[model samples]
Target: MQHSYRQLADLLSKEIRAGRYQVGERLPSVRSYAETHHFSVSTVIRCYRYMESQGLVEARNKSGMFVADWKIQNASADKTTQGKKQPAPPSVEYDKLISLQHRMTELYSLTAQPLHLGLHLASAAPQWYPCEALSKIAQRQLRQQPWQIGDYPTGTGLPALKTGLISWLATCGIDLEPADLLITNGSTEALNVALRAVAQPGDAIIVESPVYFGLLQMIENLGLKAIEIPCVPGAGISLEALEYALEHQTSVRAVVAMPNFQNPLGCAMPEKNKKRLLRLVEQYDLALIEDDVFGDLSHQQERPLAIKAWDKSGRVIYCGSCSKSLAPAFRIGWIAGGRYQSRINSLKLSSSLITPLFEQAVLAEYMQSGALPSHLRKLRERLVANIPLAIAAIQRYFPAGTQVVSPAGGWWLWLELPEHIDSLALLRQAVGKGIAFTPGTLFSSSSKFSHFLRMNIGRPWGREMEQGIKTLGKLAAELHV
Candidate 1:
């Protein structure tokens, strides 16, 4: 029923998503793709252009077509299984995760906490914050209203903060009103509130493979089971696989995702795919929890739109925060609960009561002072600039066949180390050498990612950072079996 060019585009898209092509690798020329597939060059060109518009592939001025970094690497194992439908992932293993957590705790307790360097943490360094400006604002607020700190905060949030967030959300393409928003302690609390609002204990929630560890922890604590769908290199959750899951798994109650600048992976879901995702969720009547904490840290000039931007029926529960982009200690986060506002408010009232009023006031004033845009411009520039330096180090120092993912907009860099090396063992050795990074084993419910790891690229790049990475490389080499 599809047109020939559309059919060809779909076929090539599957190949790219299957790990047949690597990120930053050049695609076959239009002439060659046409000759091999027995299609006209013009048709192939049209297909390529369409894919470009979808953020799948990009055309260089004279260098030919290439896959965008945002759509970078597929799961390495997918290379051999191209065109085959991935089977339903096994139910999330609670015991395995608990053991992994224990091991992480032991590693941390054994290391000298202050002396150990954090290649493990994803937070920006203190120097990166606009401390001088925030200090001035805080002092002025105290001088103007000395009695403000004594008051109990509203259950939902301070009205002024909600109003400011309305304008802020507009920039991200999500139009919201004060009534539609609820402030929380941080994105962590926001996610917890959203999940609790939609799902009950013993329910099944679909999540991405190699998902953020915090979400996995939330699922476990809530006594919910998880079904992970493999993610495509540049695109987000495989809509095909998701639909298949929804068809067979009637117990699935909700799905969680980070569409823009996904954690660990750093890929953005294409706009078309986001729309399709909304439609699919609507078809099956499921709720979608969208985590957009890192959406503001794009390497490019334009910010990508959130999945909630396309939600028409209110099936999407949108969550975001200032924690990653600015003022981490302020603990400012919010949700545009769409259709779930009432239940979310109830949950907010039940847990944590409300976010701090004084902090919210400070954040609101700072957001409105025309200072945030300038700060983010500089922050984004610094974060993006660090990627190449980190990648160069990885390629030069790490053992060959050690694959690293160059994220498009986020601060995290994910690495797929050689199969023989265990990240936990490497972390132990690296910790002994005064460095620490998150082992990939912590990110999933299974042991499949034990050979992987994630590094924070948000920190300022310098000799100390480079040496730490080089040392990690040396340690990885030593651990190879």
Candidate 2:
């Protein structure tokens, strides 16, 4: 009961600090707030009282609460404007890429523990998924097809799952048939196949600066070079910079992008930029690997459209998965390989033969059951509410000059700490304190983002999660130079 009120208080506190309510502005009445959030009136009263104690709001005589003239406790706005001027694309350094791979391996081995607060991985807690529904579907599938367990995967994917994915992709404004889609182990495999379909050893692939570390590892493992283009916060890759790189980097064969809710930065590309990207790719005659794994988890009423949605030239190799949205353990991801469908299918066959049949069958049934939309809706709400809580904790605890990017959608919170605070060193200290987060060094081929870090707020916001953030902030402050 107490925790419930505190959660409300914390959320409101974040809003207040974000300038949603101005000084001396009247706040919603306790009763109104309670009714809107479905909290008890008593809980709302307690919340208001707590805020009053914290100097965030003040109670008026016989009137409602008002915003107090309190100093905003959150991190100040970032000094560096994100999208104002396009910087030249950074050269892809081979030595830096090798260092990234080694550092990532070390970090993963260190954080692979049951008790670690793993805010590094871009996945949500299991409770956020419809596990009971999926389990029931799996049980029904196995009972109906008893011999499925002993069977090997026959082709690229189960037909039923592909059919279901067709309907699901339509929701994201991407129109494709099952013939165009190939299922893989997850987005990881889907991206790998997509990259292999377009580029080979020594080929240069364009990637967002401070991109997902896994993508860097893939580039390194495949012996491909990356041309790092900068991305704007809350928006995606810079079209101007990308065009510049395409013009200069003659060996570039493919451009990999997460147009919607990019990992770490949590940015999406605008529709105009997406269309322009398609045009650019057609002009360059290079493939575009669109990773839309985070597309379905929109925090807004209308979901953002993917670059694949506007593709006409078939240059866009679309990749997505249920890993982030529906199921993690199932590892069900698909690719609409566009012009490279045949190549991707061949690669898929030679690699895994097929994605697991049972899990695909289970997901197919679950999707058709009309549960995914509601499940995603509830999951998005949880993420929306949880983001601010983490940000508020960061503001209250971290040292001054810390800047956090509050993305419109997705579970990540990208933070820029004091310039001298090495996030990797902070991660080491945080691990000692039973917390884990992604050091921004892993995100880039260069050490440009050594002061940055990414946090996953997909877990349920609670005392423990807040404590983890607090510990990370303390560690960051101690390392602040």
Candidate 3:
């Protein structure tokens, strides 16, 4: 199908763009790529053909494929015009530095692998998903006369969905209106839209060190510069460092953060700190983009009030997604822009015509049916049960002196590995045994967490997973020794 081909093309393109492949580098043989990805060789061949058409790569008569040498003279010119002066002649491209150390067939090379415990994948939980219920809703929508899959979600999203979200937020003491909301493909897209709407290329954005890798990737792709402030697990970013950065860095355009159950560190900013941040944002006339993707997944029933709720001047852009709470595949997320709603909406329209309509409709129906609350309750219970199990496993199997952060919410465990062991190297060894996890370095601009790893605690424990953890622990211990 055309859809499948596009997916394959996207997968390959991401890898190539991420610099996993270098110019003139040989690609993995078709058989290897196909086997690793579980795709047919024919599909991979088609993908390769598509890549060739895009000038992303070239095929050799017998040596397989190589990344093409796209001239960056124009890129260099643009960078120069943008005030980026290079010491070198600009003839040296980063593409040349890309490592060809591993076979190009590894998907994990492009993205962080969930923990070996199989506990972190959003798709791992099936019991909490109301699949049949969603199907019924979709069926009902299709049964209508002259059925349409639904129109692309406008900036305001489905009006009913927006209204449902407003009602839902009211229960948490956050009052919002349909006019304040914008629907996005997911939290990732919402963050992308927010970044594009507010930040120009080369603008400085302050981020929590050991933050989410996905956000870091977004910042990199957009050419936005980031300043990192050390963040402690169970506490948020160092306030003094952030304040200093804001005061000294006049070019700083925004503060992007995850105040609740922050990715990788799983740190929740305290209420006082949230207020202090709000005040600072107001004082500096800076925008606050809050990523609350895991807002609903806290093990604690009483969730912290969102920083957006405290924004009086409409400086906060609050983003949330059902992907974390329900299903990542659903890809349903929304943004509440207190004052920047129209700007964000315009950016969304320019980027992607709209979020898919059917998925939004189905999600709206599920919310209206009161299924989401019950699902969250069950999901929270499951995560609470699994978190301790994962912790115990790590304690039992990991190297001595390893530190584990027990988050009050979210399904991630941030592990402080032995100082000498590199998480990336550990990841390399673990993936060789069909195990994977998010390395801590990806979370920061400076890659400060090279000695740490984040384990997903969402999946059920298993023998293979435990064995993998043991192997990793032994490896870490060996490195320590």
Candidate 4:
């Protein structure tokens, strides 16, 4: 059962997530809202308060409720369909992954190579980083508070950073108290800490098929087994597939998912699917460890509400970081452990102690300066232009059946090479030609997606980018024959 405030929050959240309310829009007044909802004045006020708490709306002293720019939109397709249980992917066992571990080593080594035009790395170009902005912030912080750096930071990050994060996260519809957030090195550490808190070694956790290789590495490092549920290109994990897994796999303790701009697949789950995911997790009593590192990178003006924003039961451990959108060097990421805050905090203390306060303060100061939104707006304009250009290049140079996924957010373009082409082998040949790409095998523990590969598109398209893409397309074409 949900509280009345929570219910109203859901309806309003859905509308906001669906982009019914634009950035800087205004919501209905309490009097009108109360009459329309058939609720009393107090109930309406409570609902508004709840909405404000989530960062969805805010109250101006004299004015009524106004929307915040937190939930901006990116490039999500409106198309949605009822999800059917997909055919299960090849199962992964511990021994098999260990044997195939060499692939991980090889993939990482490739990234280290000095490819002048590296298309394999998903990190934003150095030019894209807000180095200048952060440098200014760092300098100001040093001047004002020289003694601040001497203190050993709290295990739960700096107080100001967490406080700023709450208001920032609300834009994405994830409102929380500062205490709920535990900061770590990056989203990786946040994900690592959250997983360790919820599940132990040898426990099985469900991950999306063709998942983020970084998460796959985390699972392997933790000595856990990764189970696969197919994430369709446009649709995310199907309810039927999740239900099947829940019913069949009793040992499955937690399911780690990225609902927004999901890695490798370049897909964002729809609002309806997000609600369904919550229901399934609740019904099965499973932990939903949500990775939302890419939610803010949407190409649209409206931001999608993270699934955590709709979590009423406190089961979603929402992880976020600036590695994707802001400066990666900041190493600032956090997890709002709804019901598992204490457990997450305990794990944080034992593992990393806490991220340095100086870096956290730098980020906090930058956010307060209002530079993040301005930076994202400029970056997104480049992506909107770059995606179509890259897609055009792929179409021009690749074989007939080769396909690419142009997601509304994130920094990569997922390519499904024509059947029978060995992307890994092609990558090997391409590497020597001064080109790079992320092979699909790296994203999976099983044999699936062998004909698939992902290309990094974090920079603007130009001669070098086009030439590198054409060269890779030529290699893919040669292999297809």
In the range 169-288, model 1's lDDT, one tens digit per residue, is 888788888889999989999999888988899899999887998888888888888899988988878989999999999889899999998888999889999999888889888999
Question: What would the C-alpha RMSD of candidate 2 be, to one decimal place?
Answer: 19.2
For model 3, what is the alpha-carbon lDDT of residue 234?
Answer: 76
lDDT scores in order: 0.82, 0.83, 0.74, 0.80
By lDDT: ranked, best first: 2, 1, 4, 3
| Ranked candidates, highest TM-score first | 2, 1, 4, 3
Model 4 lDDT tens row, 367-418 = 8888888898888777777888899999999988988888968888998887
Better of 3 and 4 by TM-score: 4
Q: Scored by Cα lDDT, where does model 2 land?
A: 0.83
Of candidates 4 and 1, the better by lDDT = 1
- For 186-270, candidate 3 gives per-residue lDDT tens digits of 9999999888878899998889887776777788779898788778657787788889988789888889988998887777889
For residues 1-481, could you state the per-residue lDDT of candidate 2 as single tens digits? 5499999999998998899988999887655677899997657766776777666777553245788767642212133444323221111121133356667765786687555688887789999999999998788877898899998778778998888888878877889887898889999999999889898899999999879899999999999998899997666888889888887889999999998888878877788888888899999999999998999888886788888888887899999999999999988898998889999999998888878899988998888888888899999999999987888999999999999998777899999998877777677667767788888888887878978999999988899998898888887777664
- Residue ranges of candidate 4 with Cα displaced over 4 Å: 1-100
- Residue ranges of candidate 2 with Cα displaced over 4 Å: 1-98, 114-116
Best by lDDT: 2
Give candidate 1's TM-score: 0.79
Per-prediction count of colliding residue pairs? 1, 0, 2, 12
Cα-lDDT of candidate 3: 0.74
Which candidate would rank higher by TM-score, 2 or 3? 2
